[model samples]
Target: MPNAMTKTTSLAQRLLRYGLYAILLVMAFVYLMPLWVMLLTSLKDVEEIRTGTLLSLPGSLNFDAWGKAWGSACTGGTCEGISPYLMNSFMIVIPAVVISTLLGALNGYVIAMWRFRGSELFFGLLLIGCFIPFQVVLLPMARTLSFFGLANTTTGLVMVHVVYGVAFTTLFFRNFYIALPKELISAARLDGAGFFRIFWRIVLPLSTPIIVVTVIWQFTQIWNDFLFGVVFSGFDTQPVTVALNNLVNTSFGGKQYNVDMAAALIAAAPTLLVYVFAGKYFVRGLTAGAVKG
Candidate 1:
């Protein structure tokens, strides 16, 4: 009787586990449904999209829509496609990420290691930037950019992103740096290693995890930004996000669903790829300093 009861309990536990797995599988499918639709739609022509179900498989792999989205689809009034705007995004994102990351690292280093008067107050003030809404700064930023003759330029957009990104990057680095051993900085100082030397040698090498976190964070934010890109960039400097919006909205002939889907996918591809490749690092970095701050 005891053996039979134990077997029954074990079977119940196994069934429960299977039930949990089934729920997880269902939730995952629901979450991924949109991506599934987009991929299918992008691969299908307009005819298939109109006649077939959203989940229907494409009759054949089609590259025409991808090609059009990349090089020939009209966005706004331009027929040059998203390629230029995509390049513009790259131009904006790379500089913005690098400048913001470096500046954040330096600022964090100072705040975490170098004590000075009003340092805490200064950090508090800096933190304010992280919470400020994008809308709140638009007018002021536009005016500032105009004053500096940077309005409607890729350079201006880069500057805007760097300024906006710096606060978060600084926060990440500061939290991470504060968790690091103070003894390392102290020993380096006692050894007569200067600020730059210690930073270049000891601090920076130890900063890899945080650096990855900051880079991924900033890259995703800056790359996907639509409002800033649309507002600050001129026709020639519009980022891929803006171009994708225009591509979808522009009414020329019949609506091209496949091209729109392909363009959307293209715009999203970079951030997706970044996450796919470096997602583990992002999570690891976040946890590295979790215990302290």
Candidate 2:
């Protein structure tokens, strides 16, 4: 009788597990449907895209649309394509991400390990930056950029992204550092290590997971930013996202959905690749940081 009951329980457990798996599969399909549609639309010619349903497969694989989008596409009078804009995005994102991450790490270390008078209050003010709406600062930032002679340049865009990105990165590192054992810091200090020394030797080595998470987050945020890019960047300095927008909205002949989709996909590829590669570390860092805090 006991053996029979155990067999029944095992069957129930398996059924429940399979049921959850089925639900997750459905959810995944639902989420991926849009991406599949975009890819299919990008591959199809204009005629097929206009006549066919969104979910329908392309009649034949064609690389022409992708090529046009990448190289020969026109945005208004400019026929330079997205290549230059893509380069501009990289130039902006790289510096912005590196500076923000470094500053965040330093700020987080100080806030988490070294307590000074009103430090918590200062940290609280910094945290407020994460919650404030970007719109509120847009005009002020533009004015500041003009004052600094950085208006309408890649450098200006990078500065804007770095300022906005630091808050989130700081939060990430602070929470992660807060969870670290205090004794490790104490021992380093006792051994005559200073703030920078301990950070360089001890904290950074153990920060791989959180650093990966921060980089991925910052990369995605800065790469995908359109508002700041549009406002701050000139034609030559424009990031890919702004360029994509211009390409899509350019009324050269008519709306070419295929070209627009291809451009978007190209623009989105880097952030998507970053997430796909570092997704494991991203999840691990979130979990560990939350648990430790």
Candidate 3:
């Protein structure tokens, strides 16, 4: 009787475990349903899409949608497709991420280690800037960019993005660094290491996790930014997000559902790929720095 009761308990536990696993699997499917639909839509022909059963197999697998999104899709008279704007997206997002993350690391280190007079105020001002909406600053930022002859260009978009990103990036790194031990930094300084030396050798090397965190966050933010890209960039310098907005908003001949889905997916592809590939690093970075801090 005792053995039978134990067996029953064990079986019940196994059943619960299986139930939880099934629930989680269903949740994951729900989350990924849109992507699955989009992929199928991208593969389908216009006729199949018009039939509007998103789960159905494509009557014919069409790479043409991919081709059109990448090139030959019309945005007005231009047929350059999403390729040029996709390049422009990279041109801006990469530089913006690199420069801003680098500068943010510098700012965070100085505030954490140095902590001199007005440094608090400086950080406070940055904090305040983070609260201010980008829209409120748009006119001033555009004016500033125009003053620097960078308005309506890729360079200008990068500059604005970096400026906006700096405040948030500084916040991330500052939180992380404050959690770290002071001794490692203090000892290096006591040994007559200059600011640059300590940062370059001790602090920066240890910042790998925070760096990855910032990179992933900043890269995604900059890549998906449509407002700044549209406002700061001219037609020639606009990113894929803007082109995608155009593609969705303006349709001719017929509403090309397959084409629109393909374009949207194309616009999101890089960030999605980056997240999938870098997700491990992102998780590692968060815990490593936080534990040390």
Q: Using lDDT as the measure, which candidate wins?
A: 1
How many pairs of residues collide in each model?
Answer: 0, 0, 2
lDDT of 3 at 44: 86
Deviating ranges (above 4 Å) for candidate 3: 1-9, 290-293
Name the candidate, 1 or 3, with the larger lDDT value.
Answer: 1
Name the lDDT value of residue 35 in candidate 1.
89
Tens-place lDDT digits, model 3, residues 1-293? 99999999999999999999999999999999999999999998888888769799887789899898788787655777788889999999899999999999999999888889998898999889679887898899989999999989888998999999999888878878887789998898789999999989988888889999999999999999888888888979988988888877776789887888888898898999999999999999878763343
Off by over 4 Å in 1: 1-13
Q: Estimate, for each residue in 76-188, the C-alpha lDDT of model 1 and write its tens digit.
A: 89888798999999999999999999999999888888979999999999999999999999999999999999999989999999999998988888889999999999999
159-216 per-residue lDDT for model 2 (tens digits): 9999998988888899899999999999999999999999999998988888888998
Q: Identify the superior model by TM-score, candidate 1 or candidate 3.
A: 1
| Candidate 2 off by > 4 Å | 290-292
Q: Provide the lDDT at 252 for model 2.
A: 76
- The C-alpha local distance difference test score for the whole of candidate 3 amounts to 0.88
The CA lDDT of each predicted structure is: 0.92, 0.90, 0.88
